[model samples]
Structures are given as structure tokens and as C-alpha cells.
Target: MNEQEESNKKQKTSNESTEFLNFDYEFPLDAANVIPPENSSIPEDLFTFVTDINDIAPEPPLEIVTRINSQRQQQQRQRQQQQNKPIVPPNQGVYTIIVGGKPFRLSWESLKSDGPSNFFIEYFKKKKTRVMQIDRDPDIFELIVRHLRGYYIRSTDDIQNQSLLYDATYFGLNRLKKLLQEYSYLNVGGRVFRLPWTLFQKDGTHNFFTGPLMHSLLSPHTEEGNSPPIYIDRDPDIFADIVNHLRGYTIHIRDEMHRKNLLKDAQYYVLRQLSDKLLTAQQTVAGFGEGSNAEVLLLLQDVRIVNMLPPKVTNLSIPNMLISQDWSLTQIQYKRVKDGTPHTLLVQVSDLCMQIHKSAATVKLMYEMNHADIKKMNSMANMAKATRGVNMEIYIDKYCAITIDDNQVKSIEYCMENDLIDTNWEACTKCDLEDCQMSRLILQRAICGVHLVDNMITLCALRLEAISSRFRLNLKREFLSG
Candidate 1:
């Protein structure tokens, strides 16, 4: 070899050795098969015929095998931990509750904060478990859940309202019960009706259940089960018409008698708007005869008589009187006043007259009382209490009107403000106290009668021509306004 060639060969070998030292090395999974060097003489032909890599490969070291097994075991343990991990993390305040066979995943924080310390909170406090089970109607429970989320339940359906109310009661959610306002069931007569309180409230007729009746309906009963229905003492058939009217449904009026009965029912329930509607309907179809004289249809006969006691009027029993086909008394209550004064008596009668007049606009009521009238009233009452049999002096008035002489009705004082009977007369022998001073009052303006069959009497226009004219005038006014 020349000097320059040998120097190049040495430089090449040095560069290769440097590269091998700088290279990154890692152990391979399969060891490469190596043939024996030229100096080894025993394995040349054997390696030439050997094709399988496993035959030439050496057995792995025990340390490597042990490390591989340990790695597999660690991997298996990690998989088991993943499989056993909880669905809801323990740190998060979340839980799953099954209600009525349906699962609900809800946050404990939401249930605690949103609800008003009610059943949900109380239940969780008592049972501190991650999962809970409650056997209740899921459909109704969904409503309760929404309610807890502060959603206003706008369900106007009477049945749905009743269900929600029942659930709220069952869950001991008082606030939820109040949120569903004015929903109730009424057992009116023998028939049961589901109705909303808003029906009455909407028409501004909530006064129908103002006093004791409303109290009874609202007061809670501790007895287990569904809420008791409110009972109303009224004819179901007639009340059905009222229900229809309130629900904005049209009711077919059969005839004058039907209309009259409906009006009476409306007045009894204090449905002023309904009464007005009935009156308007009647006026629209009213007819009159050719002249002022028309046959009168007397409504009530054989009315039980009640004499109004003088001075301290303990009780003013207003009887159920049907004066004409169009006017009748549906409800009347007489409150006895302990104040034995004529003024108090006058106030009560005035109130009764006003209430009746407000009920039906077609009828007019006027009362008269004087010193002689007071004596006559007391004497009649005394006679009624004393005698069990029929009294000859006590007479029952018929349907026809009776004319009074001028001498009998001396001077008639007209008091405009009082609106009741003129109670400004001198004291009588029976009523000698200062408060028992009697006055003269003329009850009827067009006709006068001593015995009117009952304690109270209502008078309307005697002539049909007058009624027809009045009705026509009202129609004209309404039409013009419209």
C-alpha cells in the first residue's frame, strides 16, 4: 500500500467509529440472528441451512420476563379501577333518584337551594345516601320538579289543577299548594264539579264566598287522603246553568219560566252581571197588549204571613214572595238586632229593600209605618202568638190591588234621603221609650192594601204597556251607546 492510500483508509475507519459512538441505541424486541466469524469453524454449514429466527434466538433473561409480568399486572389494576369508579363523582354534590320506576339525575346543590326547605331537603337530611327511591307518580312529580325550578304552572285545566294540588299536599309542599291558586272541587247538591277559583274572581264575583263559606273551604283538615270537596246547598240542574255561564258557554233559555228560574238562581248566587244579562234578554223579547190593561200573571199564592213587630224589631222575617212572573225572591236573610230602637228597625228594612232592588231592577219595594200602623203591627203579632187557630182579624191579601180612601191615609210624608219607610212619627202607647218613637210611612205609591199576604211585598208596573215602553227605551239607550 502507498502512504496516501493507507492515510485515507485510517481516516475513514476513525469517522465510522465516531458515528457509532454518537448513535442513539435501544434494545429491540427480536434479537437479530448472527453467523459465526471466520475464525469459528464449527457453525458455518449449520447456519447456512438454518432459516427459522427462533432456532437461532437465545432465551430472554429472567429479569426481563419478571418486568414484563409486573407491567401487565399494573395495566390490569388500572383497568379495574376505571371500571369501579362511581358514575357521579363523590366531590360533586350530585345524585340519582328513582321516582315511580323512572330515574332522575339531579344536583344536590340545586335541590337544596332551589326548593323551599321542603320534602326534598328534609328527605335528604334524614337519609344521607347517594341514591334515593320514591314510589310516587312520575308524571306528577315532574310538575313538582319544574315548580322547584321556579316555573309557574299555568295549567288551567280543572283536572290537572286538582292533580297538582293533590301531589303538592302529599309532598307537604304548602307553598306549592298556594301557587296553584283557586283550583277546587265542589259538591254542589248531589253532583260534583271541578272548577277554578279564577272563574269567580275573573267576573269580580268572589263576594259569593266571602264570609263563613270561604273560611270552611280554605281551612285545612289533618285527616289522611285527598282533600274534601266543598259542599254547596243549591240545585245542581240550575247551578249547571250558572257553571256554563261562568265558563263562557251559551245556555239556551227554554221559555219565560226557565228565564225566570235562571234569574232567581243568579240573584241567589249574587251574580249581578248574570242577572243583568237575563234582564236584558227578557227586555229584548218583551211584548205588550194594545191598551194599558193587560192580564196579570200572579206568581205566588197563599204566602205565609209574618207581622213586623213594632219599636224593637227583633226579627224581620221576609218571606219568599213571587209577585209576578218576572220577579221572585231567591234568597233572603233576616238578622235580629239587639238594639230595640225604631231607627235600627228602619235601617234594617232599608238595607233589605236596597239589596232586593239591586238584585232585580224591574221590581220596586216601598214601606210605610206610622203610630197607628205600629199599634196594628204589635196587636197582630200578639194575636198570632196568643192564638194557635185561625184569627178572624188577620186577613190574607189576594193578587188584585186595593184602593185606599184619602181619609184613611191622612198626610203622606215623603223623605227622600231615608229611602226607607218614614219613621218620624210620635210615640205610641205600646212603645213609650225615646227610641221607640213611631212614624207614618206609605209603602205603595200606586196601590195600597192592609194585608199583602206576607211581611214583605214587591210592586212593579201594573200595566203591560208601561213595561213594554220602559223596555223599548232601555234597548234604545243601549243601542245608541253601542
Candidate 2:
């Protein structure tokens, strides 16, 4: 009875211990992190066969996950609210400013002196002693403080400059506002821009002296911050186009006026590549080819010079003689005309010649009787009319060439890339009357008898008609010459 009873009691106790250790629900196993103690009785192969916890265990129920996330969010919101609470400074002279959930302690005297625009001054007028709270960026507010303390704020980025400017305006910092307007990186016609400083300092391969001129315009902001903008008077829209060109962007000009305006700015700034491009565009618009290769020849025959000045000398007529190309014919009707003023006769001649060299393009040609040459001719005009059948020849290079077709000028070649052809007025003063007279004296030759004709106007008109007909016939042959 004693042995059976003892065995049964022992079995009951072991059963009780096993039942205490076991539960109705299974505890989840973390296979990856689970490690066995060295003295553990568990088999090593049990761990080897273990799978990843995610693979073995299912995720928590959706409601439980949602509730947990909600609790976490609420905790974060509480922390943020605590952080946003206004901070009070301990010192009497210092005031605390809460900005963007950050506290800044500034001197009350400094705020009163430099900051605290009308907004803050009203609060001060109420004599309320409370921490200030602003709904602005704390980083930019620091810049405002720096500016109030008379520190130079060299803002090279447009965004940063704008942020600081907004804060300055809210604070009613008049000095800072003015400085920001003036000392901004670039101010083009009241349009403020803060590009990378290196852009203005950088030299371009296509433009001539662009960087230096633009650089000279933008003065660095001094500690006082009162520097005026260099391009305050310039056109912002055109300047924007220039900026695009500088930034390696292909900018399309909308119309001819825009191109012309930009060209003017480019020329003023000495942007040679841009100017050349615009000039070529101008020629293209005028219906002339990119580069004219045509040559022009002008000839004057049976030339006559007559003096209409008061008779102070022996003769009032110069005989028919070969005249220099530089010698402009004296006005037949007027005693004296201004140099640039269009002479009726010269204008008639130019129009007749242009008609002969007619094309689709507007030919830029001009003929004018020089007043200086007329006066000098008057000095020599008081002489006998010597008749020797004088003839004069004048040549102008590439004056009337028309663009062949649109296909030829599809792509514009910039002058910067190519050598510019010398397109200046060329004249040969070989047959000067004064020089010819001197030569005659040196050679001791007798001059030919003068043939003076009072009705010279009719003869000149007839000669012009003959010359126009000749030009019309030879127009093709003349323009085709290289």
C-alpha cells in the first residue's frame, strides 16, 4: 500500500508540473534570433529545421495594426505640440521668439531699435510682456536678425533671397528692404534675379567681352548693404533672353522687334557674337543674303564743275576733266547744301541706278554731293572750261547682291566664327583738280581750250538717261562678277 500510494502521488505531482508549464495558446517562435544555451537539453536539429518568423508566423490582425499606428501618431503629435510651445527667456532684456517650432532669444533693445515693425510695435505699445510667436521659417528669420545687426547678407540664390526678403518685409525692415532691392544679385528693370555669381563671371566662347561688361554691372554687397543694382534701368525681358543665351539654352526670339531690341542691348553690352547674329538676322529680314558677293561699278563721263559763288575770280567754270571718285559733283541749283542732306540730283541718280540693279531685297545704296567737296570745287571752279573729254570710274564692292534662296541661309554663320569682311567705303582720289593743275605746272604743258556750256542741266539729264540704259543692259553681267 505504501509503494503504490507513493508512486501514484509522484505521478500526480509530475502531471501537475507539466500542466502548469503548458498553455492553451501557442507562443510564437522567432527562428532567426532564437539561440539555445550550451547546457540546454533541446536538440540542435530543432533549430536547423526552424523557418523565418515571417514565413512561419502570420502578421497581426489589420485592426490591431491600425490601432498601434494610431497610438504612435498620437504620441508623435503630443511631442510636436510640446516642441511648438512658446519659450520664455529668463532675462528681462531678452525676448524669446518661436519660429517654425524653434525658439530664438533676441535682445529686446535690439528688436526695438532694428526690428519690431508696425506689427511688433503695436504689441509693444500695449505694454504686454509675452513671448512672440511667428509662423515663418526660423532659418530665414536668422538672416533677418543678421541684417538688422548691420551684417551683410550676400544672397546668391533667388529662393534664399526671397525668403529673407519676405521676412524682412514682415518685420518692416526699411533699410534691409532697400538693401535687398538694391544689393540683390541682379535687378533688371525692377525684376530681381539671384543667379549663380559665376554665371556673370564666366566667359563664353561665342560672345566678345560679354562677361567683363556684365561683371562690372553687378557690384558686391558691402557691409552697409546700400549698393545699387547695375542693371536697374535695363529691359528685364530682353535681359532674360540674354541670360538664356548665356546659360547655354537656345532662346527663340518671338518677332523682329524683339530681335532688334535684343540686338541693341547686345551691341550696347558689346556682345559681339550676339550683335553679329542680330545683324545677320537684320540682313536676312531685309531680304539680302547672309554675305553679298556682288560687285558694283560706277562711271561718270563728261564731268563739269561750275561755280555759282559771287565773281571774285577770273573764270566761273571748270572744263570737262576726269574727276576723282572722292570728288562729289557740285549741286547745280543750290549754292550750298548740307553734307548729309539728300541732294535732288544725287537722289535722282541713286534712284535711277537702283532701278537698274533691281531685286527683291532693299538695296542699301546712297549718293550724296559733299558740301566740303562742293566748296573746294568752287575754289577751283573759277577757271576757264578746259575741254579734254574727262571720264571717271568708281567701284563699290558687293553693294547690290541679293540672297539667292532661303535654303542657302537656313543656318546663320556667326561673325565670331568667321573673319569679318572689311565693308568700308573705298575711294580713289587720283584725279584731284588741284593736283592736276600742279602737275600741269610741273610739266609746263598748255591746257586745252575750255568749252563752257551754260545749259548744263539738259546735257547732264541726257547723260544720266544714257547711263541708266547702259546699266540696265549690263546689270546681270555686273552683279555676276565676283
Candidate 3:
């Protein structure tokens, strides 16, 4: 163990340390399989240090550099060309359109943006011709051309309106179609009913009113004018109700007569929804629950009794009758006892008549009964008696009096003989009262055994009975005296 031995040993240890620290760790084909060294004193910065591969640059071929520079120049030229390209104004160009043997000059810019216009423009451009033929109505084409020129159209004729719509559809003029649909109005029975075009063109089943309206709006013969209205042959009031419904408003039909008319018109027009609405309205106004027949018949009986009264009597009014229960005979019977006389009794009858007439519901009921079918009336009468203990005889007798005028007795007899009364009562009932002499002679010859005065008395009695029943009256004493 000498100085030489110690130095040699130290040198061997230093060499081993250098070899371990320099560890030429090549990235293995499967680096995941490499095992980490247990422990080492190598500085962390030395392990993280990266070599500058970019510092060792190699010269590229001249041909490759030339090709790359050429591509860059080509892209620069393209960008300059794009920036310098010309912009054509929309209104700058002109085009010719041949529609229905007529040539129309249109703006190319205007035609280029629209469906039909664009189609024709492209067609002409492809054919390299300025003149393109369109097999559309010249008038309709003119309208489209005007619209393209920013002119609004207002049409009233059904044929022209329809043709315009057709042309719009063919040409794909949605804005024009929408304009026409938005502005169409109807003139029905001398009354104008305006509605939104969308309502008539809704994509489903339509009512009688809308069907005709749509047809009229779309008919080729339909004319276009300045805010023109399509003429319809229909009752104005009923048409108004239909229009209200289409407009999404709640139908507020107050009068039963109006309701009936609306119902009839709805049926005629095949407005199923409106018909359903009117039917519901009828039931509601009649105060009859759904499917209840007896109360309706009873109301009809009351109506018949009221209709029998003379027009003068029906028009009379009794103030406070609706609020005052004392007006009933039960309350007034004892009061009238001391004042008993023919005059007093007549006054009481007059008051009772006024009370009945003053009731709007009662008046409506009476009108319904007056116009009710004869056979239907008889059936309703029978039904009423069976269901509600109503006296059908009273209703029958009233109907005979009010409906059968003395002057028209001859006509009535003729109608009965010919069975025309069953078919058309309105025609049979309408008679010339001024021709009384002729009517009286005819009545005497035709209805020899019919006593007109007795029938009148019976009709009066039936009415009195109704008044008594309605007001809960104990009018037996006054009624007997009258």
C-alpha cells in the first residue's frame, strides 16, 4: 500500500464515475421496456438540457426554392385580382320577358333575386337570348312586373284575383302572394266583410263562407281594382258573424232571431264549426240543458200563446212587471174584489198582456212557436204534455187563431185543400187584407162551418192561461169575468 497504489486506485474510481454519468442512453425501440436507474448524483438540469438541432442547417436544392417562391407569387396575384374585381349594381342591367305573346322589359337586377324572375333570367342567359317566352296571362304577368317594380296590387274581381295567385305560385313570388292574401276583402249582400287572406288560405277544411271567399279570390275571371271587394250573395249580418269567428273573436249573438238566421246561414254555407257554435248558442239562449226536449217544447207553447195576441197587444209594455210579483193575479185578486166590474177586469187583462209582451224571452219564444212546423208543433205539444204536464190543447187553439187570419181564411182553405200549407206556410199566411170583400165571400164558401169569433175567444183564453202559469197567477176570478 504505497503512494503509487493509492493514486492508481483513485484514477480507476474517477473513470467509472465519468462512464456512468455520460450514460449514452439511446431511445430504445420499445422505450417502455427501459428500466430506470435506482439512484444517481447526475444534476437534474443536465438531464433536461436539449440540443439545438436547428443550428445544423443543410442547404436546400435550387429547384425546390424556385418552386416555393413561384407559389407565393401566384397567391399574391390571386389576392390582388380579388381586391380589384368589379361590383355590378343591382339596378344597372336590363332584360326582356315574353309573356302570353306580349314582350315585357324588366330590370335584370330585380329578376335575378326572385324565384320565377330568377328562373327566367337564368333560362335566357343559358339560351344566350334576350327574349324568353312565358306562357302566363299577360295581365297577370303585368301585375307581377309591376310588383317587381315595387307597386302594390288591389283586386276585387274573383277571376283576376285567382289568376294573380296562380301566377304568383308559378313564379314563386311569395311576397306578392302574401300581399294579395293579406289585402283581399269581400262584398256580400251589399255589405262589405273584410278578412285576413291567411284565414281563407288556411291548410284544412273550410266553411261555406270561406270556401266561396277563397274561390272568388282565386278565380281566373276575378278582377283586380283599387282595394276592390269580391261580391258575395249572402246575408250581411250572418256573414259578419262568420267573419268575426274567422277573425278569432268571441261571437256575441244576443238576439235569438239573429242566432237562428246565423245558424241557417251557417248550415247553408256548410260552416261546420259555426253551425256547431250556433247550435250551442241556441241551447244556451233557450235555457235548455243539452239534449233536453221538454223545456224547449214548453217554451214553444208559451211562444205560440204570445204570437196569437194582436200586434197592438204584443207591443204593449208593463213597467216593473219583471221586478214586481204583486202584478200576478194571486196578489191582486183580493184587491180587485171590491172594484169588481167588466171595466176593471178588462184593465187587468190589458195589464197582464203588457207584462207578457215586455218579456224579450217570451217574445222570442212566441216567434219561434209562430213559425214552427205544423206537424212539429203538434209533436212538440204532445211531448210537452207527456213530459211537463203542459196543456197541448191550449197551444193548438192559440196557433189556429194567430196563424189563421179571417181575411186569409179562403187562402188557408185553399192551402189545406191543396196541401200547400204543409209545404209553405209563409206563402199561405201572407194575404191581402184590403181585399176583404173577396176574402169574406171565399171564406164563407170554403170554411162554412168554422166559427171565427169562437176561435178568437178560445185563443184569448189560452193566452190568459199562459199568463197565469208564467206569473204563478191565481187569476181564475178575473179571467172568468173577462
Note the Cα lDDT for every prediction shown. Answer: 0.47, 0.43, 0.44
lDDT of 1 by residue, 316-418 (tens): 3333332332221211111222222111111101101111121222212233344544444445445334222211121112242322222222112222233
- Candidate 3 C-alpha lDDT tens digits along 284-372: 12113654211011122122221121211211222221212211111100011112211101100112121111122222111111234
C-alpha TM-scores of all predictions: 0.37, 0.29, 0.36
Order the numbered candidates by TM-score, best leading: 1, 3, 2
Per-residue lDDT of candidate 2, residues 1-482 (tens digit): 79999999999977654543342223574653244334435435655757888988889999999999999999999999887654433334666678888988766555655544545555544555757888989888887767655677777554566556656666777667666655335666878766654453233333432354333433333457523334547799898888788687876989868877887787666665455345432111111565322111111111123312222232233232222321122322212111222211211122222111111331112122345533433333343222322211111222211121111111111211242211222232332332221000010111111112331211122112112123333443445466
Best by lDDT: 1
List candidate 3 stretches off by more than 4 Å.
1-92, 98-103, 116-119, 133-139, 150-152, 156-159, 170-175, 182-187, 190-192, 197-206, 209-231, 241-260, 272-482
User: Candidate 1: which stretches are off by over 4 Å?
Assistant: 1-92, 108-115, 154-160, 185-224, 228-237, 240-256, 263-482
Q: Each model's RMSD to truth, in Å?
A: 22.3, 24.6, 21.7
Candidate 1 lowest-lDDT run of ten: 344-353
